[model samples]
Target: MAKQFPHITDTHRDFIARQYVFFTASAAEGARVNLSPKPTNAFRVIGDNAVAYLDRTGSSNETAAHLLADGRLTIMFCAFEGAPLILRLYGQGRVLHRDTGEYKALLTDAFGEEPLGARQIVLLDVDLVQTSCGFGVPLFDYHGERHNLDRWAEAKGEEGLAAYRLEKNARSMDGLPTGLFSEEPAEADPA
Candidate 1:
């Protein structure tokens, strides 16, 4: 069975909180589509009509680049155990890097003063919530989150990380702007 809703409710929020992983999808009008699985408690529901997720330090900035090029994005979550359900959040999304003053302040509120904690936070102003059968989704056992990424970033040091981003990030494969390096003061880290 499938159900559609106008916005996220308390029930939806509860479902969101229990998930261990979520998928983000975005694309430019005529460019490549981007979808990536995210973990590490990178997401949260800010209001009945909105959800936000931290775009942690990573290799490519496809989502951000696509959002900069096109504001549309989708976030999907599935339950692999207990019950079977697939939740899709449809909305327009915006990227707020460390350079974005307001977003940075929001991060400060969520986190703390040590601003170098995570990367950018992509806020999705959701317009619709859809739920569908996820019976096809395979059941998987819960183990633990890998600490390799965080450890690697910590070991690399800020300067090394910057060099790495410049080398790996900067633009989307389709040549769209990520606005990553555009904000000069903030170290260019494309999520």
Candidate 2:
């Protein structure tokens, strides 16, 4: 059986806090839907109807692009090591660039520190919260968070990261604008 709530409840927050990972899904008009798994350490429940996550640099910026084109977003968390439950948050989301004061303030206030490869803050205004029996989900033992991304970011440094973002993160796989940078992406490098 499944239940739906108008907003996030205390129980929902607690369940979210216990989750190790979550997934985000989004799509622009006439574009393919995008889904990505994310670490929960960067997630924060800001209010009864709002949450935000610190987004790190990735190969593509589909979520941001999709959000810009269409605000629909869904975040999902399934119990992989506990009671059988799957929670989904349906919402409108927006991106705050790293240089924005809102992003800086939220990073300091909610996350304590900026993570390596940190690119943007995605704030979601959740409208629907739903939970379903996750009987099909298998339990798995937790190991630890990976540090490879951090290491890669450190090796790239700030300048390299900027260039990389301009090259890789400025557009989605389908070439939609991600709003990562104000300027248009330079011509694709020819190899």
How displaced is residue 147 in candidate 1, in Å? 0.5
The pairs that clash in candidate 2 are none
Using Cα atoms with residue i matched to residue i, what is each candidate's TM-score against the true structure?
0.89, 0.94
Tens digit of per-residue lDDT, candidate 2, span 94-150: 999988899899899898878778999999999999999999999999999998899
lDDT of 1 by residue, 1-191 (tens): 98999999888888888889999999888798899999828787888888888776788889988888889999999997768889999999987877778777877776454333356788999999999989999998889898888788888878877887776667788876687786445657898
Q: What TM-score does model 2 achieve against the real structure?
A: 0.94
Candidate 1 residue pairs in backbone clash? none
RMSD of 1: 5.3
Top lDDT model: 2
lDDT of 1: 0.82
Superposed model 1: Cα runs more than 4 Å off: 112-117, 183-191
Q: After best superposition, candidate 1 residue 41: deviation in angstroms? A: 0.7
Cα lDDT listed for each candidate: 0.82, 0.94
